[model samples]
Target chain A: MDFATLIQILDSTVRLATPLLFACLAGLFSERAGVFDIGLEGKMLAAAFLSGAVAAVTGNVWLGMFAGIGASLLMAAIHGLASITFRGNQLISGVAINFLAAGLTVLLGQNWFGLGGRTPALTSGGRFEPIILPFAEAMAPVPVLGPIYSELISGHSFPVYLAWAMVPATAWLLYRTRFGLRLRAVGENPAAVDTAGVSVTAIRYAAVAICGVLCGLAGAYLATGLAAGFGKDMTAGRGFIALAALIFAKWRPWYALGACLLFGFLEAVGNRFPNIDLGLIVLPAQFMQALPYILTVVILAGFVGKAIPPRAGGEPYVKER
Target chain B: MTAMPKWADAVLVPLISLLIAFVISGLVILAIGENPMEAMRIMVSGALGSTYGWGYTLYYATNFIFTGLAVSVAFHAGLFNIGGEGQAGVGGLGVALACLYIPWPHWSLALAAALVASAVFGAAWAAIPAWLQAKRGSHIVITTIMFNFIASALLVYVLVNILRPTGSMDASSARFAEHLRLPRLNEILALVGIPFNNRNPANISFLLGLVACVAVWVLMWRTRLGYELRAFGKSEKAAVYAGISPVKITMAAMLISGALAGMMAVNTVMGEAQRLILNSVEGAGFIGIAVALMGRSHPFGVLLAALLFGFLYQGGAELALWTKIPRELIVVIQALVILFTGALDNMVRRPVETLFLMARKGR
Candidate 1:
């Protein structure tokens, strides 16, 4: 690959990885608070549809973002209600939410827009236009770092920067804040958090809500930033991939960015090179697409390294008499 | 240990949950400017009113029965095998390879060969995750979900590059030989002097599904392995104390679960399509989760739940064709059912148990 092609791939990688970064961070918050959320995919889908639908109708990108976030939050509330209040199986709840989003998004989309389970294509006014950084055009004349800064980092939608910014923000929230300490405590041992006069339920609910907000942003980015409109199952398995990225990152915020970027780069390569010729052997595009999932499985199998989830993950906090 | 009567636990809770799910589904329909009652009527007549409807319904039920049994078997061993989709997909590959490559003297022998091959393939697909869960301490749920994606990618590659006939535009394999086609249900019923629809895809695999149900029932209840599986599911600590190997049980149950899921290929690929098609399994593997949940993971309950879902599927198809309602409405209903029955069981159970106890006290 030439330098331009390399820059092109990196540009797409930044665009593609933004959604995963958002979702991985979302999972980080919820799982850190002892809630294993597999419904991240569902929430993202629902948000994508709603945001796209709203943006198409109102012709406002910000409104679309809020609509997307609201849709995700509703699903998150349902997950919270099922797994926390009812003390139900968190995985099952997550599965149901996924199905619900997959079905409801299309169903409502068809009804609202009559476009066969797709939102109407958003115009430029409804979509998130790429923000050109200061001196990007001027810097392009220089060599090496100039093109890199201009082509790869400067020209992206606001969410791209927001997603990158969130890595540091999440790291600080997780490691520096009092609420962060309490949230980590609840995930590791809710009983102790409860004994300390903190409400385990409240902390978990807050964590889940934060997760919803981040997922909402991710979905909105997919629909309004990366793509023009909402398509049926547009989120595809990105949510699950995000979950995989979370595990690959060992649930750390900064590592999540790296994992997502790695997955994104793989996706970009799959898009750029449909088939790769390795002299004696030819690698198919399907193999390229499957690489992230395969790598995740290998990571999960402990060949690379062991990934331990939160200690109190997936368990509902039950008070003993 | 029990708060309510067995019958109520078995029947009443599901009924209430189903009712709630249907009501929500109805409201969704109403929100879409369609008449919920009319939709219900259309679904009923479309899926169950005629022999043709029953044919399609039973055909779908055949797929569900196999997949549901797969989930139930693993559920008994306290493992969630959501990889049914991937397993079933790989199983189709087995069925296709057996039918396409091997020349059998008779359809019976061909089916037998295909059944074994599919089971083996499906079990092999599930074995890695099962082994990981049993030995390496990897979460089966996550691994299985990842496997689903990998399985799809594998299927796409095999179909496009390896299985597709030369010059064919579609990514499906070549059709099976005329003689190898399974006997349709109508033909089978004609021998018994019963008139049935000849056009629908329902076939002998429906009978095989029924037989698998009985086989699963026996394996789950009548066998020592079944007893150990349930015991391990109930209390892993106690089972370990009693000398039952967790690794052994986990591997055995997942393999059986995968095999059962794999058998669904016999119905979809061998019986209906008579060829290996892309996405032939569709969402039946995921549907198995809802079926197993609604049926309480029992073989008999799986049968009833499978039939119900089969009805919903057929009816929803009809509704989509005739009305403004989308076929995805059925998926929404399935989601609601899963949400209520699987995740919010205690919501209805607690209230019902209290009511039952109050009635008993009054009596």
Candidate 2:
């Protein structure tokens, strides 16, 4: 492939993968802290609606970002209260959150905006623009990879950078910091953490809240970064994909990025294959559409070998009655 | 002023949960400028309006019966089979393929071929998660949820390309032959002077559902394998100590659940439809979870809850036609039922069990 084409592919891949990376890390945080966060999709959807609404009205992208995070925090708080505190079944609670967000968003969106299924398209003035660093742009003059650096790597919204940088930050936070230790401890053995004088509930709440924050950013990435407007069901099971990434990554923050990139590549290919014309390469657009999920099942079932979850993963911790 | 017995928990809990959900839904109805009282009344009448309505309601109930049994079967074996959606979807795909691709001279042959394909495909889908959990110790929850997405994508592909019916953008398929369909039960009932004479396909699936429910009860309570599955559910370690192979039980449970869900393909796709179509599963597999939960994982309880869901489905559609309120209110109500039932404490369990027993005996 030509350098320009390669650059285009890389640029598109990063832009697409950004949302998944944010979501995977979000799941990573919650799961690592022992709270199963299956409600990330719900949190993201709710935030996406709120973010677009705020951005459209005030025309302040930053305010919309904050609003998105705030909306997701509220969702995360509900999950925390139900699952971590009340000891509700995580799966049920997660499903409830999804149902609630889906119903509430449509209801309120229909009432608030006259639009049927989508928000009014936002202008560039309300979107987060891609930032190109001077040094990266300077690399464009060379022959072999210059176009790749300039066209592919240099341009993208802030979240693209943040998603990459969050890996190390999450890695250090998860492995290097005291909070990380407590979070891992809570997930591994809540009782042990409790005996060590750490409040398992509080740690879990914090972890889940962080997950919400990242999910919100991911949702905004879908709207402002990917499509520039909020579409009903736009998240479209991306949250579930993130969950798959978390599973594939075995709940590690750093590895989660790799997993997301793989999924992102699969998704990019699904979007890309419709253009390529070849015998045996031709799949119905819908089958191509489902390729990622099919791959996820295959991977989880056997293709990716075995995955080991935390010992105390699905169990709620409570002091002995 | 007498205190309720703790043993009445099951029945009481679901009832209380409904009361709470109604309170919440009432607030929602108020927000939309409709009277909650009028809305609820409209909903009830819409669901139970005519004999034909009951037919439609029965039709909805029949699918849930198979799907609910699918969910409960796994619960009885201590495996949460969340791949109901995927398995059902796959079964539907198989049925659609058989109906369209099989060049049988007779419709009965096509029907038989379609049904067999559906059962086999559904069983295989369920087998994947079972294999993962049984052999690899993979969590069924994550794997099954992943399977749902995979199923959606795979179905979309088949619907759009391979199975897409002529002159349709909706990713639907061509209709199966008329002879391949289940004969109208309303007409048969009409011959017997039955109350509902509408020609809807809401026919014998409910009867079939009842038989299966009873069969499930017998299998679980009376059979040797049932005891083994229940033992595994209650205490895996103890069951293992007793020389029960959990691996086999887990795999068998998932396969049965998948097949049960696949049986629902008949009610929705083959039995009900004039032709094979895309996305025939219609999220029934996912809704099965609610039925299973509301039924407290009991086969008979699942039957009643499935019927209740059928009523809501009918009511939801009718409410839209007859009232200013959105039909989605019924969906909200259904969601409420799931939430309340899932959260029902011991307070609801005993009463629910008692009621369930009374219903079974009454049946």
Candidate 3:
């Protein structure tokens, strides 16, 4: 391949990383607030189905995006209700949400769309189109990087920009704002925050709601942005990959984006590695597919120093009498 | 989250949540063009109507026994073994490899070897999370989910690279020898003239599952080890104060749970399918957590809960054949069961224990 082709490949790789970046930041928010939001996949799936259906019906991408986010916020709310309000087992509640979403969406999708496992195929009008940057097309006239500008940097869905933008916004919200301080305090010691007059529930719920909205956006990206419609499990295991990113990042927003890009780089590699001919590295495609999970396990199993979540990441705060 | 429970809330909460789930599910189904009542009818008849139908349900239930026991065992140790699917897959993979490659002629010996291999491999897979938690205080839930993905990926790779059976669309290992097939006395019920139709190999594993259930009961109730494990589950610091090693107890609990999960593969391969094919026990590992939760994490409860799960599964499969409903409805039913289980979970044992304590106080 020429230099142009190589650059184009690298650019498109970031395109593929968008949804993952969104979901990882989503996980970062909920988990950092002491909620074990393990049902990211379910939230993404539910959002995908809802967005696809709504987009197909309404023929409006933004509506679909909002609807998808709305679906996940509802899911996140349930997570909050169960884990925080009712104080149920964090893991079980998350698992239940996943199971509930998996079955419910499929059951509803098949009947509504008349597809065995999908919604109707959406048009560009009904979905996101890659936005071309102004004068970037003119920049394409330059040698060696023209194809790269057109394919990678110039043309990609709008959510790609938003996903990138979220990194800084999340960092600011989580580190610079008064809300961020309260969130940190709540995760570490709700007692201290409660004594200081912050309602732990309100802060935690807002954090979780943000988490849900991101998950919804991730789902919308998967269905309307990436593929133009929802496949049965269109989000596939991408939510889980986002999860892998969250763990690798150790619950920090900016780190999660970097982790997502790295994993998304692997994912992009998995999609293209068949073309690479390393003389004797005859590792099966199957093993390559397992790379993300393997990397996650290796990370979790102490390759990184102490994934020490906020001192109280999974605990619910009940005020002392 | 309180250890103690109020009486009025106990039964009503689970039932109400369950009712809400059903109503929500019904709304979804109605939105999708299916009748809720008709679907329920199909589900019940499909699981309970006939002997053959019941046999299939039992087969599903048999695996649940192990999965439930596996989850219950881990829950006791404060480890959430969510890798039931991956662990079961590995367990199935282990037995398949042994049957296809290991040089064993005697039927009983082959079965024993296969079961042992599965138990060890399954146990070993579980120890990854166990060691991580014990050594580094890494979160078991995340680690376990990560393990499930790794196991899933590894299973796919193993099937294609190593275990590909010839002339098959399904990637699987070579078929088990007939001698290794689980024996069926479901046919032998004819000797007393109470003849049953349908000749399926519903083998002695159900009986073995029952035995495992009893053994689990004994392990949890009759042994001092059980006492220590339970004490540790209730309060790790207290257990340590009582002189029990938290690490040792945790390691033992996880391994024991993994071993039981592995044995579910034996029951599937040697007892029924007689072959360790791909996706063996399928989602039984996940369903096992629900079983354990519903059973309130007691051995006897796990047994009864597994049977309930098996019944739904068998019924679900049968319902598909007889009705126009998709097989995925079974998944919906399983989800419902789990949702209800979680809703009921916080109160299940607390009240009964409270009652026992109250009686003791009164005396």
Candidate 4:
């Protein structure tokens, strides 16, 4: 491919990978804290709908984002109540949240907007626009670095930058903070963490809440930054895809970025070429779309490597027991 | 420490949970400016009032029965097996190919062939995931879920390129020949001199589902393999110590589960639609999970749970058509039912057990 084509593909990859990055980071927190959250998709969908609906009504994107985070937090709280407080099955609770979000978003959206489960399209102030850097225009005349600076690194919606910044923030928080150490311990051995005077329940709840915030941002970005409005089940299966990426990355923040980018690059290539011809045969676009999932299965099957989850993940903590 | 009778534990808990779910759903209806009582009445009349309603309800139940049985079989062997959706989808392809390519003299023979073809196809789809989990230590849940999406994409490719009738705008294949169509419920009932709804889509596959339920019951409770499967599920390490191969049990359970899920296609593609189409499964696979959970993963319980969900589904359609309530609200109701019955079971069970214990102590 030509330089322009390559640049376009990389741009699409950045846009696509941003949401996955946020979601992967979100799952990393919850899973690392001993709470398995398959409900990331549901939280993101709820956030996407709330953000789009609120932004349309208030004409303020920032308010929309806050509302989105609040909605996601509500879902996270319900999940925590079910899995942590009630001591219910974690996977079942996650599935329930997904169903709830899928239904409630469409039901409420249809009732309020009367647009068949879709919010009103956003205008300038209601959506995130791409911001160009100051040096982009001035550096355009330089040959190789010019296009890389202006095209690759410069223009993107605000969430794209936030998602990238979160990678280092997550790493530092996970490795450097006392709370992070406790959280990691809780996931591996809650009894040990409890013996150390940490409240396992509290740490897990906090992790879920943090997950809620990240997922909310991811959803808000999808609704306001990527698309102009929310549609029913707009998150599609990205939440699941993000889970696969989490496994692919071995639950590390830096590796999560790499996995998301790789998956995003695959998606970009699929979108660019609907049908790819090789010397012997042509490959359908669907194969590329399904590649991440296929690869996840392959990786999990030990063809590539092993993916070990947190030791105490998916088990409800019982302090007395 | 026995707090309640076995019968009450089996029946009372689910009934109480269902009641609670409906009460909450009623409030949700009221919030939408609709009369909850009126909505209930409409749902009851729409889903169970007439022969036509029963036909649709039974048709939906038939689909659920297969998927539920599929899930239950896997659950018995300690496998989650959430790939029922994909298995059923591929089963539809099997049904379609059998109907389109083969020249059958009668519907009965065609039905048998289709059943075999679907079971094989579905089993093949599930085998890879099962093998991964059994031998490679891959988590079955993630792999099965991934397979669901891959199955959907695969179905799309086959339908769009290979199965579509020449020059047809739709993505479905041509309808099966006249003799290849399974006999409708009305036709079967008519032979016994009973009046039935001819317009509804329920057909002979309901009988097939009933037969399959009985077969599953016998296999699970009466047979040695079933004992081994359950033992493996209860404690894999113990079973291994007792000389039962973990890989063998996992593969056997998953294959049975996949075959049952595949049987759902006989109802939708052969009996109802008479043509293979995209979305023929229509989330029945996921619904099966709830059914299996509610039924406690037993064949008889699965049958009842499938019937209950069928009522909800048919009734929900009526609510959407007659009232301002959106169709998606049914999904919320289903989720709440699942939350209460499966996830939040201890919430009700603990209170009831305490009450029973107190009563026994007083006596």
* Predicted structure with the largest TM-score when compared to the true one: 1
Ranking by lDDT: 1, 4, 3, 2
Selected candidate, larger TM-score, 3 vs 4: 4
Question: Among these predicted structures, which one has the highest lDDT?
Answer: 1
- Once fitted onto the true fold, the runs of candidate 2 whose alpha carbons sit more than 4 angstroms away are A135-145, A275-288, A298-305, B1-7, B97-115, B164-170, B197-201, B322-331, B343-363
What CAPRI-style quality would you assign to candidate 3? Answer: medium
Top candidate on DockQ is: 1
Pairs with steric clashes in candidate 3: A34-A313, B47-B315, B61-B310
DockQ ranking from best to worst?
Answer: 1, 4, 3, 2
RMSD over all Cα atoms, model 3:
3.3
- What are the per-model numbers of colliding residue pairs? 0, 20, 3, 0
Alpha-carbon lDDT of model 1? 0.95
| Per-residue alpha-carbon lDDT of candidate 1 for residues B78-196, written as tens digits (9 for 90 to 100) | 99999999999999999999999999889999999999989999999999999999999999999999999999999999999999999999999999988999999999999999999
Calculate the i-RMS of every candidate, to one decimal place.
Answer: 0.6, 2.8, 2.1, 1.0
What DockQ score does model 4 reach against the true complex? 0.80
List lDDT for all candidates, in order.
0.95, 0.78, 0.79, 0.91
The sequence of per-residue lDDT tens digits that candidate 3 reaches over residues A1-321 is 667656755776797789999999998888877777888998999999999999999999999999999999998988887778766777887888787778777777776776875889998788898788887778887876666676667787899999999999999988999998888888888889999998999988998899899999999998899887988767777878888888888888878878888887776776776434578767666666667777777777777665667887778788889
Q: How well does model 2 score by local distance difference test?
A: 0.78
Q: What is the DockQ of each candidate?
A: 0.89, 0.40, 0.60, 0.80
